[model samples]
Target: MSTGNTIPISDLITSRPYTSRSFLRECPERDPVQFPALWYYPVQAKAFTICSLCYNTIIHGFESGCGISFGSFTGTKHQTLFCMFGRPHPKYLYKKGDFLALRTFMASRTGLKVTTCHGLGGANANLSTTWYKPRNGEINGMVSCEACYEDYIAHTSFSSRFEKSAPQPAGQVWACDIAVPLIRRTLEACSEGARNDWRVFVAATTHRLKVPACEPYKERAAQSTRWFQPKDSLPGFIICEACYLDRIASTCIQGHFTSTPLSSGQIQHQKSLTCMLSYFPMAIAVQEVIFSENFQLWCEAAKIFMHEELCDGTARKGKSYTLIVKDGTGDADFNICQSCYTCCIDLFGFGSHFKQFDMKTHTEAGIAYSDWACDFYPTRYGFSKYMDALNEAVCVREFSVLGDFIARYQGVTQPCPRSTFVKGRRWYGTSDFSACPDCFEETIQGTALESMIVVRNQFKETECSCDIYSPSMRGIWKNACDTYDYAGFVELVRHRASVYWQTVPVMKRLLSQQRIRLMQQQTLNGSSMLYQRLDMSASASSSINYSGYSQPRYTYGAADVGYGYASTYGIEAARLGQQANNLVQSSRSDTTQVPYLEALWEAVE
Candidate 1:
């Protein structure tokens, strides 16, 4: 065997000096060729150990004077170290007494190689493997994987407090609870105080770990019974107890929120409550509010922001507004709702490109007023592309540069044509309704079940269901794609189609009866005075305010809101028009039927 060239030193030191600050630097990448060595400072009460790589980095930093170095070192060869596999922790420096104890303990055990824990590095633990956990049943939930136990706890005074947990049932997935940030921090604090009391560490972390995971982790665990809402009532803005505790409880604006108990009845009746704070943007906004200590400013800003987020700006009572941008020809117009204009355009410094369109003046000119919708509404397909283009434009500080990208999505309400199927183009979905290459790429291309969908071979003039604006359908597709349940998705689609066809005939008969009744009523009230009274009644009803707002109530039928999929298979234009009236009538009387009807309509349309 040949050894690489090595330099001879006058004196080979067995140990090096390093400080707590020097260990703060990033650890070097692990090299498998070098056996792992554990090194620690002698004076500290820190419970964790650093790997050879980090130990070397700290020494180098000390030698280079890059870090303030102070402390004696004790070194020992270990099979594995936590720093090599777990998240970086500045407090993971070794103590000489603990290191010597760990070395003595390792020496006693012959042929023991605890290389790595199954749950180290944020990975799910293999519960069937040998692992250590708190002996007390109350806090037994806190688990330390085998590698972590050897590296951090086995040599510590509190090692006696933990016992080997029974190998969990095979196929069970469990993450080492000790790896959680809160628990890790608690352990670090315990080490700093040189506290060998296991109860202290357990008491500090038990409640936090016991709190149900934040809203985003709802699937893994149930939410707490309590939730928090803003003191200034903002509809639909709710934060789970867990998120509130973790992110908001200690914040400056914590007083601005009030806790609300979620009863079992309410939980059963309503959809799973989501924590609005879990949204990345909302979380960031809350953090900003915390930093600024301006809850009122956030509240005022949230009125418009939340309104834009919650309301789609369709069929509202108040006067609708639009931002119309004209191309060079002046004939081409791009309409954006006030919400979109304020949030997407003006917020991004692109307001100069658009002019406000006066709906009242336009209607006064005899042009019929149309309900305006934001082009970049959250539910809209290809919204991400618009956002990407906006981001690119912002990055370059040139809005005009991405004109083609903007125009590409504008007025593209129809499905891709057969001519779009050029060579080397990939399509997704079934033959009956396939997504064009562009739509697939924008929406479903990278989804989990992307390969599960059969590629369309026969190029036909079929409508693309991918562009449908129904939230329910999109949600179903998303769930199916996430779980790779292609068969279940197809079954659901077929089931929905069956229900739709069954409802269509019933809807048609109801609409026909309503139309006949209306005609009869008109015939009975043939007098002009009678018509005047009916008009007056309608006007009075419009002025009535059931809610706090004085705006007239406007109801929209399915037909009034075009799904941009009129040409979809098995949907007749006349039948659709008739069903629209029925939908409108049903919506006014029975709001529960609206989602069912909409979902069915979305399935085929």
Candidate 2:
């Protein structure tokens, strides 16, 4: 068989002791192939310094026809970076890859595909990827070449065309090493409860290994058989260990945000029923309860999560919960009057948003400012910064909830098949607009019936005199409605006596959405109840209090003392700009001023 000459891929992976600290501290590439993964194998202990050549290698590897060979180097200032050079030029026509999809692939893999396309070009390249192993010594930096590299080029080329213009995927090795390990560790800890070890095993093999197990090997490992398969019964890429374990959260297990099992009584057919609770106006506000002082102590008694939950009890209380707040722009004053709805959508998939308002109003005499508009008065919410904060908050909440919930619930200990809750409905703003299987069949069945009616009425009537609406657009909308069984529409007309021209259901659905907003606010009470709660600086929100205005004495004023008055009076400009900013500065000055004044008096004594 010439087995000795042919080195198996498995043999390429050698067992090397991996310690979080050691791996982080030193580049073990020279020691041996301790880590598993093609990108990280062929161990070499060198500081990762990727050059132009390495970049070209990555690009060429990803660009199917681009003839480029990549040489990766370690033991330098830059860790695990490769110099990509020379377009290898393909002999055959490489498929014109989907640039958009390739960009998506690069993004998903935490790699950059920087080509000559984007104006910035190679200047954007980072010397080190966060994925680079970080430690405390000369070897503190190590490249995750194979781990990040792999067949990334091949995958990126097919992913999307967007990768062509953006930065070529770099630092992916570092990203994979850092992100995957962190995520896997988190998942493994969560999956510890699963007796079969299926959750952790699947995560390690598929996500960590980034490959499928061969069929022959799967058949022999009987004792660990369950570990090889997905518990959810859906066949696709295996989830990472952390994500798999996080699924054990109580929300998933309790079916609060997911689907329920279909009973046999409902369907005579062999297929299972699918249901899901689709949320509306997808983007929701995440309100973190903030306290003025040490108010978290009352949380348990109040039966609410408070600011302390965000930090330790020793610190102040702070934490946020995802919720759908009503858009109050239509109201008379344009205020988001605290109306809210519970955010009941799944954690991943599509995401949500939190909307801010401009609460400024002008009076006849002058522009009178309200407390609501204070945050944005100077420079309306820094939109980008606000969005960034919102994203961080959401990520933290999603992961934290998953972690906490899994610990409390046992059903999610392993993958389990579950049914959809409400089929055919898509939330308006949140992601997950694509129609699922349940809606597909229903719409197909309804199409013929609808077509027949439209044909029958084609010649019977003239168009409406109003002429404001388009029958075609309405028809398209109707088809969309039919195709997607919107729970919003269903709830709008649930109590109709007849099917002809039903209106009550629609009104009810609208009212129901509003009610949700109110409930979101009323659920939690006590010191934590406030709208604008965040960790911004104290001075940014407070008013400055100074005993007197700074008045420089003028010699000329003495000449006119009898005829004129020396006076200077106005609130500090900063005090007017940001109330809290004044307070913080004022407090500091006051603290130091008192000591100075005391020292002066002592010298006189």
Candidate 3:
């Protein structure tokens, strides 16, 4: 469908009742733009022209006191100039004809020409150096950042509260000492190119770190114990009756524990969630090695171990693998180790955090850690080297996930040759937007495993290529878009549609068959009911009352025999019954046969 008249985009967008005054019949004047308090704080119009400079000056002085310098800072005058007036600069608020004058002034003042400063941070950059803590506390739940401050003014002053409260912080500065240090380390390790890809890597890391930590802040204090209170040793904390049992099988079902036991038997109550990680550091050793530090060496060795242990002769048979090291004699034997299990699970997942070992680490010729002596092994042969290797593996895993997403979108088809639609023609892997051969075939496109699943579902021993121009395919794509992190699935669908418009005919045909099958099933059900009614009528006629129908005139070969009419009707009734049976059989056949067609339609769609 066509709209009756061509409407301007701006008019269409501003057509809503709340959007513009002309759109609504009657209403008091309200703010044109809606500001999200979660995104920015609301301050009075006057505050921007007064408090902002004071706020900026204070922050500037504070930073200066800390031996830091800000290239630029926001002032109250700028806030009112931007928020109250929709102009680029203070001069622009007064100027009527000269928009370029503001740019000229900005260049003169800063001694530099600038366009934009988007995508400035990286995942593996020295985050500590850039971390800043704003002077003002969180307002309206949003961090007080320079961008947020500017945004607050750019939109209308949302709330009158800013009028009463002190001036909002000039801008947000990096906060959280732990987060700053970790981010810094990450940035330092990342390559320049990787760092430059700020929107993807850096943003994702920061986003993950921003996840709110659990609350009900724990106060650090020593637990007081009553001397000789009980005969049984309850230790530092009480254990739940259900989970208190010792030496239970791994498969045995259980509930939340009163404490995280040292083993299946020994009880050790945890104070907090952090304690869960900190209590057993070795348990996460593999994870730390892969994600926290460089763990290339350990990853390689781990992979080889997994392949040998998990797979049976065939290279492609293994889905995943795990490794459990038994430290016969170590500090872990006497204490607790949580990192131990995590390391094995991470390797099993084949997550980017762990890297596979090189030829040297895999071979006997090179230095490698043994499960027995590695815990306290000397330098060069020490376990720290292995730990470092694991950290690299973790980084690799993260990069791998990111790289895979990028590669898929970019369509890097060199490594994995596959056919994709291009202008209603088959375009092989040589196209500019070709996909990665391995990822495309093994993960995204189609695979033996998927074929096996399809065959099993259909109860067929053979595999077949799936039709891309099918409703089922569309449904699958929609589901992936909804469930997975691929934000560009819809774009890909649009691209595919543009490339393969001709496939629309095939999809329509499949959809038509699907609709027909539904109609036919309904028809068959109706026919079955009609046949049943015919049988009931025949039964009634066969058992007719002689008193009501003294003589049946329309009997076959009646020959003036009034009493024998019932016999003739019974014969005719038997004939009708046979016909009804035939119709019922036909209806059943139609219902059964339509299922096959429906299956085919699903495959095509």
In model 3, which regions exceed 4 Å deviation?
A: 1-499, 508-512, 515-519, 522-526, 535-539, 542-605
Ordering by lDDT? 1, 3, 2
Q: Please, what is the TM-score per model?
A: 0.37, 0.18, 0.18
lDDT string, candidate 2, 1-605, tens digits: 11122222222223322323112212222112211111221112222222332233334456434332223323321112221111111111123444444333333332343211111121223633222221222122222322333222222231121111222255432223222333334333443333434334334434434422223101222221112112332222122222222232222221212222324552344232111001111113111111111112111111111111211112111122222233432212111111111121222211233323333544456865444321111133222222332232333233333222111221111111111223222111111121222222123212422222211101112211111023332343355555664454233222211221133334344445545533433343211222113211222333244575433232111321221112211122212223444444454544554445445322321
lDDT of 2 at 118: 16
Clashing pairs in 1: 40-94
Worst 10 residues of 3 by lDDT: 32-41
RMSD of candidates 1 onward, in order: 22.9, 34.0, 32.4
Residue range with the least summed lDDT across 10 consecutive positions in model 2: 273-282
The TM-score leader among the candidates is 1
lDDT of each: 0.50, 0.25, 0.29
